[model samples]
Target chain A: MKIILKNICKSYNGRKVIDNLSYEFTPDKPVVIEGGSGIGKTTLLRIIMGLEKPDSGEVVFEGVSHEAVRFAPVFQNTRLIDKLDAPANVRLAAREISGDAVRAALIALIPKEELGKKVRDLSGGTQRRVEIVRAVLAPSDVIIMDEPLTGLDEGNARRAVAYIKENMEGRILITSSHSDLFEAFCETLLLK
Target chain B: MQTLSLSAALCRVTTSITWADSLKNGTARKILIIVFWLLLWQGASALVHNSILLAGPYESLLALCSLAVTSKFWLSILFTFLKITLGFVLGLITGILCACLSYRFKLFREFITPPISVIKSIPVASFVIIVIIWAGASSLATVISALVVFPMIYHNMLSGLEATGSSLIEMGRLFRFRFIDKARYIYFPQVLSHLHSAVLISSGMAFKSGIAAEVIGRPLQSIGNGLYLSKISLATADLFAWTFCAVILAYLFEKAVSLILKRLSAA
Candidate 1:
């Protein structure tokens, strides 16, 4: 499947965040958007995910209707339910995945004891990892992550990257981060 | 100070402190507080020296016992309980549905504002009189109770829905969550938190307004009628007894609702 953005323009409070941007996303190559903070890396990802409407542009998808394309996203805020445990939060989107499967997937990045604790109680790095597991386990044609490695230590960040690569299953992956941690695995898209 | 070994003195002080802490936090402390209030009430009743003016706790308990043995008293309790509960459940359901619709559609929310404002502004007594004229005395309590509950639940649920984090909703959208999944994960907890307080407050208000409606309408076999009869006959003890029963019923219902909501939240 191919996703293309043509001359997308978005402004907030009379200031342009994304201006005259165009890119084509292919399933074969994962793309990592890199830019300075508040450089509209998130706005670009949100626009592609249909979370925000572009001021002037159209997104064209080939081999998939926009309505039919499902997405799994790791929001910048790790939007896991604060009151739910790790596996339970993962099951929110991945309902078809069994509880055992969720637990097994989470156990790879999360400690066994910590898996039962609510996401709010876990450390920031653990919560980010939980978001990654949730995104990977959810049934989707595309994965959009906004700074997926925000709170991770270097060691856990590597593990998360490795985990995402192993489980992405040839789906189009688009992520935004200020750092180049994903440089080796993903094609870089610099947002000026 | 008496000379003593450090260990012995420390042990004694620790024991005293533990005892004080238990007294402050344990069920025994609650019982003691209640007993203190009961004694104060009894003292005030004695000072009045007239049962008609002020019924003591003993007189109220005695009146309650005498009423309990009679079939009419039980029937009145059942009648009022069923009517108020039905009204409350009706209000609860409609309030939740309306709140959901209002949250989904801004036009509906605006359209509903006037009626909700009227309900909140108008006195319960006025509503009771109007409802009696419209629907007659037979269903007055039910109608009044429902009106009392609806706006409260509606406003609280609406606020809860509004307070839900937008980011979580966006996440749900990206995940392509089904409607049921969105309700379960994204909305349920937020609404439930607000619902807990709303139900508690509204249920109590429903009982109070419902009984007041019955008193005003003089329904044939309701707690309100019983209360009215007790007042006119100058049987202060019976009035106190009926009021006691109403308070207990309201408390029990609130407890049951709170328990159910708590369980739902846990799930």
Candidate 2:
């Protein structure tokens, strides 16, 4: 399956964020949207994920109905249920994943003690990791991550990237980051 | 020898002072405060020298004990308690459903505004009279209590739903979460916090209004009827005792509801 953005344009308050952009995202290759701040990387990701509409143009999903396409996203904010623990947060989106699997995934990036603690009580880096795990485990045709490693240190960022790559499972992965962290594994789409 | 004895005496004094300090700061302090108020009430009653006009705490307790042994007293309590609780539960369910509808649809919200406003503006006495006429005296307390509770729960729950984080909701949508998952994870915690305060406030209001309705409607075998009878017969102690019973019941019910809500949030 493939997603094609044809002449997509979006603007806010008369300022164009994404203008006349076109791209094809295929499952065969992972894509990393790299750009400086305010370059519309997040906006483009949202458009592709169907969270936001383009001002003029369309996103054509080939080999699947639009309704049949499922997305798992790591938002700019951690966007976790604050009252729920790390494993519970993942299970909210990935209910089919077993409890043991959730705990195993979480223990890679966070301490075992932190597993039962509410996501709100975890540190920023730990919360980001929880978000990553949630997206990775969720059953989706496409995974869209907006700065998934924003709060992580270099070691954890590398670990998160490696985890995400291992679990791609033949699904298309579209991520936006200001750094060149995913350049080694993902085809860079530098948004102008 | 003089110095040793002086040091021992100083230590004893310090220990005694510490004990006194702890008493003033603990549950002992609360007991003392209640005793103080009871004494003041007793003194005032003594000065009045009229048991009919002002029943002392002792007389009120005596009245309660006497009523407690009677089957009619228990029956009246059960009648009022069941009716008011039913009304509250009905109001709670209706309010939650309405709030959910209002939150999801702008048209429903607009449609509900005038009725909620009317309910909010009208007096409880007026509703009791209207309910008595429409549904008869037997159902008056239940209807009135529901009328009183509905608007409070509706308004508060609506506010809670409105205050929910939209970003999280959007994330839920992106993840293709089912309605139950969205409600359980995204809406429930937010609404539960607001619902807690609403329950505490509305539970007391429900009991007060429910009893007032029974008193006006003269419902058979109700606590409100018991209060009315005591008043008409100049049984001031009995009246005070009934009032005490109502307050205690309201307090217990509120605590129970709070506990259930706390458990729901935990789960």
**Who wins the lDDT comparison?**
2
Listed models, DockQ each: 0.72, 0.77
lDDT of 1 at A20: 94
Query: Poorest 10 consecutive residues of model 1 chain B by lDDT?
Result: B1-10
Local distance difference test, per candidate?
A: 0.91, 0.92
Candidate no. 1 TM-score: 0.89
Per-residue lDDT tens digits for candidate 1, residues B1-267, read 455687789999998888788789986688899999999989999999999999999999999999999999999999999999999998999999999999999999999999999999999999988988888998987898899999999999999999999988888888877899799889998899988888999999999999999999998889999999999999999999999999999999999998898899889
Off by over 4 Å in 2: A107-116, B1-19
Candidate 1 wrongly placed segments (more than 4 Å): B1-48
Q: State the displacement of the C-alpha of residue B102, model 2, in Å, after optimal TM-score superposition.
A: 1.4
Which candidate number would show the highest TM-score if scored against the true structure? 2
Give the fraction of native contacts in model 1.
0.95
What DockQ number belongs to candidate 2?
A: 0.77
